[model samples]
Target: MHAGLNEVTLPAQGWMPTLQSALREATRQQHHRLDHHPLLARLVRPGLQMADYGRALQALYAINAPSERCIADYIAAQGYAFDYAAHQRMPDLLADLAYLSLPVPPLAWAGPRLDSPGELVGCLYVLAGSTLGGRVIFRQLQSVLPVTASAGARFFAGHGEQTMGMWQNFWAFAATICSPAELPAARQSAAALFERILTLLESQSC
Candidate 1:
């Protein structure tokens, strides 16, 4: 399997055992408050199959790169600066721990490739949801921990009232992409992504 991607073998029933196991651990370790969030509870069921979620992710994958570029551009255009030292240090720390580096494929951020605001928000939610569990672990690490002084790190912070409205728009956009039947699938996709993120985080921590 390719590192940083889902090339690993899954079950015949399409249940991602590795993903499921990781999430179960993550839930126990970090997202203790997630059970209190109604949205999250509905999204992550214990017996949910991984293939169902993979389908939903496949549906959205085409739009993901452009959406991420949009968010990165938006952050840059807002006059915010990234902490290059922290960014550079993080990969180095991970490398020291023998973790494979994350892929950094070239991203295009200009022209008609730009995503709409709502799409951008939805994408952020997906990204956040996927990585938040792992971030909790990173936040606990003293050496590589994130601080508010870091520019890009602030993106991990939850939205406040003013900025939260934008997230509402994102939620609306996400809603349009799924139906009642597909909601389960979407949740599964989200869980799978989260699990993969946790694996990366764990590798980095080690």
Candidate 2:
């Protein structure tokens, strides 16, 4: 919603940097910030505790639930050809919370608005990329915590063995649906979602 963003548009295809590359470059700093955020960092620390892991899940759930809904709703309303349900993280988050016997935290913020297809794609990029990253964290958590995909680490466990395949499928579909004209909106929305999550985590005890 910056001044005159609506007036600026690129071609439907043939952009120099692809949408994924552009999104990664635009949100690189934000991505690094989140990776080192204390609460998240605590998950992979040698001294990681079940309590710390539980708190982290609660914090993630606060932002994840609502943000996911926004994307799913947008996809449905727009009649987009995406199978967003297959990529949703909330179910796994909920399972982990249940195993830990932690209540779902109230939403930390309003979540992002995906009023356009470009915006929805941007949010999807962040969410899907996070899923890929979570696999690494899952392995790290396995060494420290007594949790597994079923017991308490379901969120980080992601799609298990099929994760890479699913991730590639998502990006391929994203490349097709996202036009050059939508890259700015996609980049801005992806960056903003990362910022939003960082803000939410910063405000929490984790």
TM-score of each: 0.34, 0.90
Q: Which tens-of-lDDT digit does each residue in 104-132 have in candidate 2?
A: 89998877887776787789888999999
Worst 10 residues of 2 by lDDT: 1-10
lDDT, candidate 1, 72-178, per-residue tens: 67545533232112221222222322222223323223212222433332234555443433243224322333233133233223232323444333343344332
Please give the lDDT score for candidate 2.
0.83
lDDT of each: 0.34, 0.83
Model 2: lDDT of residue 24? 89
Runs of candidate 1 with Cα error greater than 4 angstroms are: 1-30, 33-125, 128-153, 157-161
Tell me how far candidate 2 lies from the true structure as C-alpha RMSD in angstroms: 5.7
